[model samples]
Target: MAKFIINGGKKLSGEIKVSGSKNALFPIFAASLLTEQPCRISNVPEIVDKQVMVHLLADLGVQMNVSPHEVLITAANINKTDLNPELTSKLRGSVVLLGALLARMKRVTMSFPGGDSIGKRPIDSHLQAFEALGAITQANGVIEISAEKLVGNKIILEESSVTATENAILAGAMAEGQTVIKLAAMEPHVQQLCEFLNKMGAKITGIGTTTINITGVPKLHGAEIDLIPDSNEAASFITLAAATKSTVTVTGINPEYLDDFLLKLKNMAVNFEVGKDFIEVNAPTVDYQAIKIQGGLYPKLASDDIPAMAILATQAVGKSTMNEWMYENRLGYATELMKMGASVEAVDSHNVIFTGPTPLKGDKMTSSDIRMGITLVIAALVAQGQSEIEGVEHIDRGYENLEERLSKLGAEIRRA
Candidate 1:
């Protein structure tokens, strides 16, 4: 087990280049199974989740060449119909392969997928969409799905679930007719998947909306795609800048996705400058005001991000409420901040109220999930004295070389 020992009270100041979207790259990797040709994915993050996905692909006889930031996958000689359960259980994105396998081999058998224990994330939405498109599903302990042919039909998703919507689109892209998806997830990663499928000859419209239309293609060819930078990771850096009262530049961000979120942070008196492809966040000198935030589907603060925001709120002077409506257990990580002397109270499982300007003292902490783990690290950077953080694997599952990146920004953090 790896851990991070952070010597706190350092202002992070420097430029750090952001990596490709971990959320975007996983689905795209699974989508590679839809083609038998070679696919090149650039800007891939060298993280545990990506490694798990690559291992799963290799188990299916797909050849992969990986570097620090790029992956090339060729699936011309797939040899297995069953995905490795152990690998699949390591990350949530492993469920994405169900769509590709069902599309290509007409059958797939895999165990229940697992990842961070955030809450009850059901795969029923994925199954319902698959069954709607002419596939049969069987579940006892393991899940088995098979179909002779998938004929496209209109699918009104029960909820705007991101993974479920992506699974539906992947399955419907190769179906025989037109598939109209209502109440679909319009996250940026979903849009990237749609654009990627279109490049491979699948017809898809409504790239960034609640409803999507996909015309099935008999076969999809391999295409080259550059994954987008991770906005959530970038947001973490922005929050760190604000907490430490330092100026740092985050490079290679897509401005369109960040404008609204940055604007909200600015409203809280955080200063930042946005360029075409980068954002420079300057820390505030005076006591900052806490801002109320609500999490929603898209164009709202992402649920995965609320934990980090909660940590940032501890540095402000007033109280702030973060209402996380999506996941029930996400606010549990805030308790770690309270351990560091931050006045955070969990109103319920989903809501947390923060009373700020708490003089935090470094304490031993453990990471419950990826985002929260990193949030703890951010809190440690601003706290006084030394802090030991365990469960570093959770942090590495999303962020790549986080200690190295923070060190480049002059943070006193090291791996142990």
Candidate 2:
């Protein structure tokens, strides 16, 4: 029930270090179950979703040592094969354990996963991939999967689902013979997982391509890995700088991962300079023109970043069209922007047209999802009066010390 009180009309100016990738850490944490030895993961973000994953691991009898930015996981004495429904229902990433559990114990049972209500994010792809890897899946309110010696085969994903691709890789890495995955998601996180698996004795090739081949290994040993920085979070902060006419430097960013997003920001006339490990974005005095964005699997505007762009468009000069073909309910949070005087109309479940340079006046609003919650906070920082954002737990599930970081950049915001 925590809320954020933000006083508006302040230009944010400072440098803030970015946190580890939330998306990367979840699958990596699940991957720890693939080995009985201790797997040490660094750059772990201290966020709510991470805590949920840690709790789920504990429920499965894995010993875990958690710090602010590091985690040590030992799965030697894992005595349980099933995840608790009550705990697994807390976050969408909980579904990631299915592949790991099935690989280790040949069975997994869990209820449907839950998190941000962005839309109908079905796990059919995950189930489909599991079935493709010689596992039997039963679905009702809860899903039950079991296998007797997973044998690898060719898997062409119905969609380029990131989680499903990760699950298949995890499951395939331990299966007998070779497994080939086609039309897989080629996101940076997916590539990171493939690299980590290769380091752990699993033979994986084509790390950054749509087609991945995994050769099963009899056993995988523990290895140390540092996760890539959270590119989505960095993009959100860059959009904030552009919206509020601020200058902010984000450290710990990977330039290669941000190439596509930076180009899009450049198209909007936002000034930026990229370093080897950092990127700085400086906002303009006058509002910029609207930009069109389309979402795809990779090398496209991430669907998670659409809400942030929607908020940034409110400060732009003309109409902006955002086509979020990924999720349906993602645009629902735009109503909160309307409360702040933004002229955003949901053309359909998958599209929104925003007309702006609208004078935003702060109001009380609730966060609907992780990215949208952060977007609302960005809007609150640039809006006219004081604004209160409820459901801050959603924001905590992703960003680390968001208010503190923004405050360092001269924003007037505090957690209450």
Candidate 3:
């Protein structure tokens, strides 16, 4: 197993470019299967989850020409419908392939998908959405979905789940009639997928809104697109700079996509400036104010960012409470933070309280999930001594070349 050894108290100063969206790339990759023509996508990140998706698509006879920054995928000769369980089980994004494959091949069977173990993330919404789209679903140990001919219908999602919304959009794009999705996810990545689909002959509209309309077409063709920079990554970098009182700039990101997080930073008295396509954060106040973080749908604080905010809270002046009702185990990292001398109380599975200006002392810890892994790295970078973090593979699943990138920013971090 790989570990990240860090010598804390280094003030990171430099510009770091944000990577391509991990959430957006999965649906786009799965959508490529909708066409036989070659689809080229640029600005692809070399994350572990992406490699897992590439392997999964390859197992289905899809050919890919992968480079450092892009992938040219040709799914013209796909020969299988049952997903390889080994690959599928390692990536939660593999679940999006169900709607894509069912639309292209009329059937799909695979075991449950997996990724971060932050909480009980069920696929009930996805299965329910597929059923609404004229597909027959069988759920036991293995999940099977098939449709003789997918006919469009009105789908009101049980929850605004991002992956569930992507699946519905993928299937709805090629479903026989007009499909309307209500209470859909309005995430930037979700909107990016809809835009890519439209370029490939899918008549989709009302993007970046809760209600989406898809006019199904008989077939789709190949298209090329560049992915948006990852807003979550931008938020993480800003959190790191603020926690360590560093001056850092994150470029290649759309500031509009990160309004919620940026607003939170402003509320906490973190000095930051947003430009056309970049964010430069200066050192925060010596005694910053603590504020509550309430997680909700888009236009609100994302649950994925809660851990980073929690790290910031440790350096704030008062008690900061985080309410993340979306995921039961979102606060699962509190114990790990406590080990590093943070004053944290896991109020429940969904809520946590952090009290601060606490001086963090480094300690050995284990990562539990992707966001938690990076959150610990930020904590370690801001701590008083050396810290060692195990299970960095979880970190690699999201951020690409994290240690190297942070090293460029002058962090004393190395892989061992």
**Candidate 2 lDDT tens digits, 66-115:** 87789999999889887888887788888889999999889999999888
RMSD of each: 1.1, 1.1, 0.9
By lDDT, is 2 or 3 better? 3
lDDT of 1 by residue, 1-416 (tens): 99999999977788988889999987899888899888999989889899899999999999998976888999998898898999988989888889988998889999999899888888888999999999999888898999999999999899899999999999999999999999999899999999999998999998899999998999999999999999999888888878777899988888677665786687678888889988898877566788887778887777777677776688777999989898887776787888898887778887889998788899999998998898999889988999999999999999999999999899999999
CA displacement after TM-score superposition, residue 258 of candidate 2 (Å): 2.1
> Between the candidate structures 1 and 3, which one is better when assessed by TM-score?
3
**Which segments of candidate 1 are over 4 A away from where they belong?**
none
What is the lDDT, from 0 to 100, of the residue 281 in candidate 3? Answer: 88
> Per-residue lDDT for 190-266 in model 3, tens only?
99999999999999999999999999999999999998998888889989998999999999999998778888888
Name the runs in model 3 displaced over 4 angstroms: none
TM-score of each candidate?
0.98, 0.98, 0.99
Worst 10 residues of 1 by lDDT: 255-264
Model 1, global lDDT: 0.88
